[model samples]
Target: MTARTAALAIAMAAALATVAGCGRKAPLDTPYQAAVDARKEAERNKEPLPPEPEKPVADKRFILDGLID
Candidate 1:
């Protein structure tokens, strides 16, 4: 089609994609939950449970402490 029509279609598609990603209350925890479920299954089967993943530390300085000195 014409250049103007093509540009308008691209702009609308971009806007639709941007809006579609909004409104999530929190990120998915599927990986962590899967790990927990695996551990439970292992326990039921009398096998060793894998170690739980560490929760993220919220402190900004936790990362900077090593580099600061």
Candidate 2:
């Protein structure tokens, strides 16, 4: 094939590949989209996820109010 024709074909292929790639969204596109969706679903169901951690328990044993040691 002529050099000019070959160059044109290569250029067209590259352009087509670039255009094709533009339509794909990476799994992590929004990063937190999955978390947001899960939160919405949990809110709708009025249920907390099992793996969620609870706040630390406060110490109620007793503490000296005004001790200096």
Deviation of model 2 at 68, angstroms: 73
CA shift of 1, model 2, Å: 0.7
For residue 13, model 2's alpha carbon misses the true position, in angstroms, by 0.3
Provide the lowest-lDDT 10-residue window in model 1.
Answer: 53-62
lDDT of each model, Cα atoms only? 0.83, 0.70
Q: Report the Cα lDDT for candidate 1.
A: 0.83
Model 2 agreement with the true structure over 5-68: per-residue lDDT tens digits: 9999999999999888885566563425566677678889999853443445665654774473
C-alpha RMSD of candidate 2: 15.0
* Superposed model 2: Cα runs more than 4 Å off: 24-69
Candidate with top TM-score is: 1
Q: Which residue pairs collide, candidate 2?
A: none
- Which lDDT value does model 1 have at 4? 100
Which digits, one per residue and each the tens of the lDDT, describe model 1 over residues 35-68? Answer: 8888889999999889986655555657668987
